[model samples]
Target: MLNIALAQLNYTVGDFSANTTAIISHMRRAAAASADIAVFSELAICGYYPGDLLEDSSFLARCDAALDEIIRTSAELPELVTVVGTARRNNGPGKPLHNSLLAIRNGQIIAEYYKQLLPTYGIFDEYRHFEPGPQTACTLSVREHRVGFMICEDGWNQPGLDYKVNPFDALKQATPELVISINASPSDIGKRKKRHSTISKACQETQLPILFVNQTGGQDQLVFDGASFAVTPDQGVVFEASQFEEDFQCIGFDAGAFMKDGLPLLASALVDLPVEEFTRRQILLGLRDYARRCGFSKVVVGSSGGIDSALTLALAAQALGAENVIAITMPSVWSSEGSVSDSVDLCKNLGIRLHTHPVADLVKQFSTGFEHSFDTPLRGLPLENLQARIRGTILMEYSNSFGALLLTTGNKSEISVGYCTLYGDTNGGLGLIGDLYKTEVYALSRHINQQAGRELIPEPIISKPPSAELAPDQKDTDSLPPYEVQDEILKWHLEGDRMPPAEAKAARNHVQGLQTSEEGRQLVARILAMVARNEYKRRQAPPLIRVRSRAFGSGRQMPLAAKY
Candidate 1:
C-alpha cells in the first residue's frame, strides 16, 4: 500500500526561511500520519512568481541552503519520501535555471524532474528565468510503487501539442503505477472543474492513479485556491481536498487502485456556488493572504458609500475580521446625508469601526489658499479630483499612523476607461477587486446580501442609481456607456482584440437599436481609445489579485507609445 500526503499551504516570494518552515511543519505532519510520500505544489520552497528575484545569485544561494537543510531534516524520517518544487541552477556553462521538483528520500536528493514547458503567456513568464528541461520523465521507487512526477504546467497539455512537449509522452518510458502533479495554479471561476476533468482523463488513459496537489492562499495579485485531489485509474475520485484553504490529506493506494477499507472516500461534488459566494471567498482569501504575507494585521479603506467602496469594506471585514477592519467616511459638501447613513449602517451591520471625517471644511480651507491664484473657479475635473485626493490623504494619514495597509477598490470597467483618479482613489497599497468588471461588482453585491439572508448593504446602495458623487449629482451614465453595454465591448475589444468593424457590429447588436446612431459609434470608439491610452496608469497601479484568465498586470502587456 502507498500512503500519499498532499501539502497545500501558502508561500511568499523570496521568503526562503518562512517557506522552508511551512514545508517542515507539513513534513512532520505527513511523517506522523505514516505517509510513504508527501507532495507539495510547484515552487513550494521559493514561492511562485519570484519574478526578477531569480536574477540574484545570493537569493538563489539562500534557496539552495534552505533545500540542503530540508534534505538533512528529511533524512531522519525514513518512512516518508518528499517531492517539492524549487529553483535549481543548471550545471551547464552560463546561468541557466530550471523550475524543478526534487525527490528526497532518506535525507538525500534521489531524483529531480524539471519542468519541460515553461509558460510565457499571461501572469506566467517562466521562460524568462528558467530553461526548459529535457523531454523526459523521472520515476521513483516509493512504497513499493513506481511514482512519476510532473509540475504545474506539465500536466496541462494534450499529448501532441506543438507549442509544448507533453509530459505524458515522456511518461511512456517510466510507465509508473502512480503519478503525482505538483501545481501552483491560480484560481478562476469554474477552473477547478476543468482541471479535475483533465486530471481524471489523464489517469484513465494512463491507467495509473494520480495525485494532484495545489497551493492555497494568495501571492501578490495571484490567489492559489487549493482543491487538491487524487483520482483512481477508473476516473473515480479517491479523495478531495478543501478550496481556498491550507490542508493536508493522506490517501492509500495499492497496485494502481484506491485502497478504500470500509471507509468511503472523503469526497464531494465540486462547489458550484453563486458568483457572489465565489467572489466573496476569493476576496477574503486575497485580503487575508496579503496581510499575512506582507506582515500587516489591520486594514484601512476609504468608504465613499459607493458600490465599489462598500464591496471593498465587506471583503476587508470578512478577511481581516470586523475588529481588524477600519472604515473612514470622508464626506464633502456634495456628499448627501443618505450616503453617510448608508455607510454607517453598513459598517454597523458588519460590526466594523466607522470613522466619519467631513471634508467640506477642509475643502473650503484648501480653496481659500488657491482663490487668489485662480481667477475662475475650479469647477471641472480639477474640482472633482481634489475631493477624491482629500479623502485619499485622510486614509493614508490613518494608514501611516497605525501601520495599516489601505485596500483600494476600483473595478476593471472603470479602470479600463480611466475613470479613476490617480493618487486619489488609486492610492492604496493593493487593488483588491480591480480585475472584476462593474457588472460583476453588482452581481457579487447581490450575492453577498443574499448569502446573509438580509441586507448587509443598504437598500438605497443597491437599488439607487450608481454614481461617484464626486460632483453635484454625478451619475456614471452621464460620462460613460451603461455597464452592460460597456463590458461587452471591453470583453470583445480588450480580451478578443477584435477589429473596429467587428467591434462596432457587436456593440450595435448588444445595445440593440438604442445605440445605433453614428454619434454612439463615436462614443464607443472614444471609450476604446481611452482604454488604449491609459495603459500607463494601470502599469503603476498596485498589484491586482487575479481571479480571471486575463488580468491587467504582468499578463496584459501593451506598448506605451504604440498606436495599437
Candidate 2:
C-alpha cells in the first residue's frame, strides 16, 4: 500500500529560495500525513515559463542548487520519495537545456525522465530553450507498485493534433499500475472542461489509472488553476483538488484502488465548474496576484457611474478588500444626476470611499485652448474625447499623489472598435474588465447583484441605458450598434471559432443574419473597418487581465499598419 500526495503550489519565476522553501515545506507536510510519496507540478523548482531566463547560465545554476537542496532534504525522509520538476543542462542535445523530472529517495537520485514534447505554440515557446527529451517511457517502483511518469505536453499527444508520439501510449507499454503526470496548464474559459474530457478519454484509451497534478498561480497574462485530479480507467475522475488556489492532499493507493479516508471513492463525482463561476474565480485570482506582485495595496478607478467602471470596482473590491479600492466619480456637463448619485450609492454599498472630481470646467478650458491654438473650433468627436482625457488626467493625479494603481474600466465591446480614447480613459496601470464584453458586463453585473443578494452596485447603474456621457443626451447606440449586436459581431471577428462552441456557433449565426441584406452587411463592414483602424490604439492600451481564450494583448497579435 502506498499513499501519494499531490502538492498544488504557487511559485514565482526566478525566485529559487521561495520555491525551494515552498517545496520543502510541502514535503514536510506530506511526511506528517504519513504519505509514502509526494508529487509536485511541472517546473516547481524554478516556476513555469521562465522564458529566456532559462538561457542564462546563472539562472540554471541556481536551479541546480535548489534541486540539490531538495535532494539533501529527501535524505531525512528515508521512508518517502520526492518527485519534482526542474530544468537540466542538455550536454548531448540540440538545445542547451531539457525539461526533466527527478525521483529522489534516501538522498539518492533513483530515476530521471525528460519531457518528450516541447510545445511551441501560442503563449508557449519551450522549443527555444529546451530540446525534446528521449521518446521512451519512464517507470519507477514504489512500495512494490510500478508507477509511470510524463510531463505537461507529453501526455497531451493522445489528441494527435500536433505531435507524433503519444507519451501515454509509450508509458502504457510498461504496464505500470498507476501513472503520474505533472502540468502547468493555464486556465481559460473552457480549458478545465477540455482537460477533463481529453484526459478522461486518454485514461479510457490506455486503461491506466492516472494522477494528474497542476500548478496554481497568476503569472502575468496567465493564470494556472490547480485542479489536480485522479482518474481510473473504469471510473474516469474520482477526485479533484481546489480550483484557483493552492492545495495539498493525500490519497492512498492500495491493491489497485484509490482511498478517500481509508477506502476507495467513486470516480463518478468529477464535474467542471460553471462558466460564470469559472470566469469569476479566474479574474479574482488574476487581479489579486497582479496587485500583490506589482506592489500595490490600493487601487483607484475613475468611476463614471457606468456599468464598466461599476463592474471593475466591484471586482477590485472583492479581490483586494473594500478598504483597498477607491472610487473617483468624474462627472462632466453631459453627465446625468444619477451618474454621480448612483456612484455614491454604489460606493456606500461596497463600503469603499467615493471621491467626486467633476471635469466639465477642465473640458471647457481644453476646448478653448484647442480653438485658440489650432485656429478652429474643437467640436465633434475631438471635444467628446477631451472630456475623457481630462478625467483621465485627474485620475492620474490621484494615482501619482497617493501611489494607488489606476484601473481602466473599458469593456470588450468598446475596445473592439475605436470607441475608447487613448491616454484618456485608457490611462490605467492595469485593466480588470477589458476582456469581458459589454453584454457580459451586464450579465456579470446582474450575477454580482445576485451573488450579493442586494444592490452592491446600485440597480440604476446596471439598468441604465449605456452611455459615454460625453455629449448631451448621448447613448452608446447613437454611434455604434447595440451591444447585443456589436458583441456578437466582435466575437465573430476577434475570436471566430476559438470561443466556446455554443457562443461561436451563435456568433457565426448572428453574423450570417447580419449579412443577409446590404444594410446589415454594410454595418458589419463598417464595424470591421473600425476594428482594423483602431489597432494602433489597442497597441498602446495598458495590460488588461486576460479572462478569455483570445484576449487583445498576447492571445491575438495583429499587424498595426496592415491593410484590411
Candidate 3:
C-alpha cells in the first residue's frame, strides 16, 4: 500500500519566504500523517504565472535559496519524499532556465523532471520564458513502487495546439505503475469537465493509477481553481479534493488488487447544479483568494444603485462576510430617488453596512471655483465626469483610512467600449467583474436572486433599463449600442479576433432583432476603436481576476501606441 498526500496551496507572486514556509508546514503535516510521499502543484515554490519576474536573476537566486532550505529541512523526515515545482538554471549557455519538478528524499535531491512542453499562445507565454525539456520521463521508487512524474502542460496532447506532448506516452516506455502530474491550470467555463475527461482517459489507457495536483488561488490576473484528485488503475477516482480551497488529503493505493482486468469507476459524477450557483462559487473563490493572498481582510465598493455595483457587493459580502463589506453610495443631483431606494434595500437585504454621502455639494463647491474661467455650461461631459470623480475620491479615502481594498464594479461590455470614466469609476484596488460582460452581469444577478429564493436585487433594478445616470435621463443606449449587440461584437472582435467590419456585418445579419444598418456598423467600428485606444488605461488599472479564456491582462497584450 502506498499513501500519498496532495498539497493544493495558494501562492502570491514575489513572496518567497511566505511560500517556502507554507510548503514546509504542509510537508511536516503530511509526514505526521504517515504519508510516504507528498506532491505540490506546479510552480509551488515561486508563484505560477510569474510573468516578467523570471527575468530577474536576484529573484531566481532567492527562489534557489528557498529550495535549499526545503532540502535541508526534509532530512528530518527520512520516510517521506516531497515533490514540488521550481525554476532551475539550465547550466547550458547564456541564462537558460527550465521549469522543473524536484524530488527530495532524506534531505537530498533525488530526481528532477523538466517540463517537456511550453505553451506560447493565449494566456501562456512559457515558450518566451523557459526552454522546453527533452522528451523524457523520470521514474523513482516510492514505497517500493516505480512512480513516473510529469508537469502541467505535458499531459495535454491535443494536436494543432502548441505544446502537444503527452506525458502518458513517455510513461508507457518506463511502464511505471503510478504517475503524478503537477499543474497550475487556470479556471475557465467548463474547464473542469474537460480536465476530468482527459485524466480518466489516461488512466484507462495506461492502466496506471494517477494523482493530479493543481494550485489554488488568484495570482494577478490568473485564477487557479484547485480541484485535485486521484484516479485508480481501473479509472475510478479514489479521492477528490474540494475546489477553490487550500487542502491536503491522503489516499492509499493497493498495488496488488489492480493488475487484473478491472475498471476504475469515477468517485461520483459532477453535481448538476444551476449555472448561477457555479458562477457564484467561482466569483466568491476568486474574490476570497485574491484578498487573502494579498493580506486583505475587508473590501469597500462605491455603490451607485446600479446592477454592476449591486452584483459586486453581493459577491464581496459572500466572500469576506457582510461585516467585512462596506458600501458607500455617492449620490448627485442627477441621481434619482429610485436609485437611492434600490441601493438602500439591496444593502439591507445583504446585511452589509451602508453609508450615504451626497456629492451635490462637493460637485458645486469644486465647479464654483472654475465657473468664472469657463464660459460654457458645466452640464456636459465635464460635469458628468466630476460626479464620478467625487465618488472615486470618497471611496478611496474610506479605503485608505480603514485599510480596506476598494473593488471596482465595471463590467466588460462597458469597459470594452470605453464607457467607464478613467480614474473615476475605475479607481479601485481590483476590478471584481472586469471580465464579465454586461449581459453576463444581468444573468448572474438573476441567478443570485433565484438562489436566495427572494429578490436580493430589487425588481426595479432588474426590470428597469440600464443607465449610467451620469447626466439627467442618461441611458446606456443613448451613447452606446445595446448590451446584447455590443457583447456580440466584443466576443467576435476581442475573443475571436475576427475582422471587425466583416464580422460585425455578419453578426448583425445573423443576430435576431439586430439592425444591419450602416449606423450599426459605424457603432461597432467606434466601439472597437475605443477598445484599442484604451489599452493605456487598462495597463494602469488594478490587477483584475480573470474568469474568461482571454482576459484584458496578460493574455491579450496590445501596444500602448498602435495605429491598427
Give lDDT: candidate 1, residue 1: 81
Candidate closest to the true structure, highest TM-score: 2
Off by over 4 Å in 2: none
Q: In candidate 1, list every pair of residues with a backbone clash.
A: 75-107
Compute the lDDT for candidate 1: 0.83
State in Å the error of residue 184, model 1: 0.8
Give the per-residue lDDT digits (tens) of candidate 1, residues 1-564. Answer: 888877999888888989999998888889998888888889888899898899998989999999998898898887789899999998775438989999998788899989888888777899888988888888998856898889988877854464646788778578888888899888876667767877877777777677889999888888888988888766467677888988988777776666544354644565555556777788789888888888999999898888888888888887888899999998898888888888998899889899989998877777776676876666678888888888888999999999999998889999998898888898899888898889888888888888889888777787777888888888999998888878877766665532234544674466454357887677678878989999878977878887666788876888888886
Q: How accurate is candidate 2 locally (lDDT)?
A: 0.88
Which residue segments of model 1 deviate by more than 4 Å? 93-95, 162-164, 236-238, 260-268, 496-523
Q: Is candidate 1 or candidate 3 better by lDDT?
A: 1
Q: Sorted by TM-score, highest first, which candidate order results?
A: 2, 1, 3
- By descending lDDT, how would the candidates be arranged? 2, 1, 3
- State the lDDT of candidate 3 residue by residue for 275-343, as single tens digits: 456667777888887788778999999888889999999999988999999999988988989888889
